[model samples]
Target: MGYLICILLYIAGIIIYGIVMGKKKVKTSDDFVVAGRQLPFMILIGTLLASWCGGGGITGSASVVYLYGPVVGTLHFAGAPIGMLLLYFISSKVRSSTKITVPEVFAARYGDGASIIAVICIMLAYVGLCATQIKAAGNIISLITGMDANLATVLSAVGILLLTVSGGMISVAYTDAVSALLMVGGFLLAIPLLIGRAGGWSEAMAAIPAERLTGTGGLGVIAILGYMIPTISLLLGDQNMMQRFASAKSAEEAKKSNLGLFAAEITVCVLIILMCTIGIALFPSLDVPSNIIFSLAVNYLPFVLGAIVLVACVAFIVTTADSYLLSAATNVTYDVWGKYLNKNADDKQKIHFMRITILVLTVLAVVLTLFFPTILSLQMTAYTMYGAAITPALLFALFSKKVTKAGGIAGILTGGVVTVVWTMVLNSPYGIASAIVAVPAAVVVILLVSALTGFKGEETYRRLYENSKS
Candidate 1:
C-alpha cells in the first residue's frame, strides 16, 4: 500500500506539472512548434537532455552497459555526446536560418521536393525508435510492479498523446525540462545509494561478464567501426537535435547550449555508467538487465527514494516519447501536409493537424510496441536506417551549395535503397558498418548520376558541385 501510494502521488505530480506548464502555449502554431523561437538556455538544455536521455539511455543503454559493458554503452550513450559535438559545428547556422526543420533546411538549399522527400524518409525511420520508448515504459511498470505490460504501455501512450494534444512543442519542451530536473535529481540520489547497496564501488566493478568490460565481441576493428558508423552518421542529421537548435533564442545561444550540452552529456554518461555498473555488480542473477535500475530501487530503497527513482524513470520515458512524437508530427504537418496537401492552410489548421497527427502517431507507436520484439532491436534498426539514409545527404547539403538537384535525388534514392535493401532485405553482414559503405555508396551514386543527368534541382549540376569544392 505504501509503495502504491508513492507511485500514485508521483504520477499525479508529473501530470499536473505538465498541464500547468503547458497552459500558456496554445495561442498559436508557431508557439507550439518552435516555442515561439525564444527558448532560454536552461529550458533548451532541459528539453534536449530529456529528449536524448530517455528510456533508451536510462534502460536500454543501461542494460547494454550492464550486459555488454562499457564498450556498448559508449556506442549507445556516449555516441550522443559525439552527436552534440558534431551539432555544435553547425549549431549557429542551423539555428539562425529561418528553416523550420532539417528537411526544411534541405528544401531551402535544394528545393521543396527534396525537403519533402527527406521528411518522408526520416519520419519512417524514426517510428520504430519512438515506439520502443513507449514499450520500455510499459515493460518497466509491468516488470517492477507486477502489473500488465500491455495495459501499462497503452496507458503510457494515452498520457503522452494527451500531453502532446495539450500544447504540442510547448507542452513537450515544458515537460522535457521538468523531466530533466526530475531525472538528474532522481539519478543523483539513486546512484550512490544503489552503489552502496551493491556492497560498495569495488564490488560493483568486480561484477559482470569479463568480456563486457573489454569492448570486444570477437568483432575485429572492421566490425567495431561498422557498428559505430551508423550512430555517427545519425547524430549528424537527426531532427530532434535540429528542432532544439531551432528553438534556441539565437544562433549564439544554440551553439553555446550545445557546448554546454556536450559537457553535461559527459557528466551524465558517467553517472549512468555507474548506475549500470552497480546494477551488474549487484544483480548478476537478474533475468533482464533493462529493468535492473528501477527494480533494484523499489526492492531495496525505501518507498520514498524508490518512488523518486520511479518518477525519474517515468519522466525519462515521457520526455522522450513526447519529443519524438512532436518531431515526427512536425515533419508530417509542416513538411508534408503544409507543403504538399494544404499549402494554403492557416495557423489554426496547422495546429489542429499537428495535434491530430500526434494522436494518430501515439496510437501507431502503441500498436507497434504491442507487436514488436525487444526495444533494443527496434531502436537499433531505426537508428541504422536513418543514420545511413538521411544523415550524409543532409550534412553534405548543409555545406555544399553546388550540389545539383539531380545529385540530391541520387543521394537520397541511393541511401534509402541501400539502407533499406541491405538492412531490411539483405541484412548488412560485412565487417564495415553499413553507414561506412552506404554513405560513400550514396555520395558516389549522387555524384555520378548528377554528372550524367545534370539533374541539379535549382542550381546547375556543375555549379553545385563546384560550390561544394569552394
Candidate 2:
C-alpha cells in the first residue's frame, strides 16, 4: 500500500507537470521538438543521465552486481563510461554540425536514401529500447507490491504512457533531472542502513559467489567486452544522446553536459554497486535476478525511505519511456513526415505532426509490452541495429576528413545489415562482440566503397564545415 501510494502520487505530479509545459504555445518545430535549441548545460546533463538510468541502470545494474558480484559490475560500469566519453567526442562534432536529426546528418552527408535508412533504424531500435524499460517497470511493480502480474503490467504501462505523452521532451528533460536527483539521494541515504542491517562488510563479502566476486567478468574479458562494444559505438549515433547534443545551447554546452554526465555516471553507478553488493550479503535465496534491488529496498528500509527510493526507480523508468518516445517521434515527424509527407509544412503543422507521432509511438510501445515475457527478453536488437549501422559512419565522418558520402553510405548499410544478420540471423559467430565485428566490417566496406566511387561532400555541408574550421 505504501509503494502503491508513492507511485500514484508520482504519476499525478508528472501529469500536472505535463499540463504546465504544454501550455507554452509551441510556435516552431524547434520549439515543439527541441525546445527552440535553448537547453542549458545543467538540464541537458540531467536529461541525458535520466534517460539512461531507467530500470537497467538501477535495477538491472543492481541485479547484476548482486548476482555477479563487484568485479563484473565494475567492468560493466567501466564499459558504459567508454560510451559516454565517446559521446563527448562525438557530441563535439554532432553539436556543431548543420544537422537536425540523425537522418538529416545522413542526408546531409550521403543522400535521401541514406536518410530513409537512418529513420528506419532509429524507429525500430528505439521501441525495443523503450520496451525494455516498460518490461522492467512491470517486473519491478509486480515484485515489490505483490500485485497480480497482469494488472501490474497494464497499470505500469499506463503510467509510462501518461508520463511519455506529457509535454514530450520538455517534460521529459526537467522531470528526469528531478528523478535522477531523487534516485541518487534515495540510494545514498539507504546504503548505510542496508549495510548496518546486513551486519558488516565482512559478512556481506562472505555471502556472495566466489566466481561472481572477482576477475575479468567471470564470463571472461572477451565476452564482457563483446557486450560493451555496441554500447561504446552507440556514443556516436544514438538518437537519444544525439538529440540532447543538438538540444544544447551551444557546442561547448553540449561538451560540458557530456563531461557532467560522465561524473554522474561514475557517482550513481558506484552507489548502485554498493547497494547491490550489500543486498547480496543481506538477503536469503533470491529468485528473480532483476527484482533484487527493489526487493532489498522493500525488505529492509523503513516505509518512508523505501517509498522515496521506489518512486525514484519509477521516475527513472518513466522518464526513460518519455525520452525514448520523444526520440522515436522525431525520427518520424522530422525525418519522414516533415520531409516527405509535407516538405513545405509550416512550423505549426510540423509541431502538430510531431505531437501526433509522440502519441502514436507511445501507443505502439504500450502494445509492445503484451508480447515480450521478460524485460531482458525484449529485443536488444534495437540497440544493435542502430549502434551497428549508423554509429560507425557518423563517428568516422566527424573525425576523419577522408570519409566520403560513398563511405558513409557503405558504412551505414554494411553496419546495419551485417549487425542484424550477425547478431540476429547468423548468431554473432565465435561469441565476438557484435560491435567489435560490426564496426570493423562497416569500416572495411566504407573504405572499400569510397575508394571505388571517389565520393565527395556537398556544398551545403562543405560551407558549414568550412565555417566551423574558420
Each model's backbone clash number:
9, 0
Query: Each model's C-alpha lDDT?
Result: 0.74, 0.75
RMSD of 1: 3.8
- lDDT string for model 1 (1-470, tens) is 45545655665666666576567556777788888888889888888888777887776667767766777666657577777788889777667566767777667655777787788777777666778788887876776667777997887787667766777677678668777777778778888788788778777777666777786633466655554666667777888888888888887898888887787777778888877777777777777677777777777687778788777787778778888888889999988899889999998899889888888888878777765566765676677777766776777676665567667766887787777777666766764455666777877876686678654444522222332110
Best by TM-score: 2
| Model 1 worst lDDT run, 10 consecutive residues | 461-470
Instruction: State in Å the error of residue 64, model 2.
Output: 2.7
Residue-by-residue lDDT tens digits, candidate 2, 383-452: 6677778887766655665567777887888888887787777876786656777778887888888788
TM-score against native, each model: 0.90, 0.93
Candidate 2, superposed: residue stretches over 4 Å from native? 370-373, 377-380, 428-430, 458-470
Cα-lDDT of candidate 1? 0.74
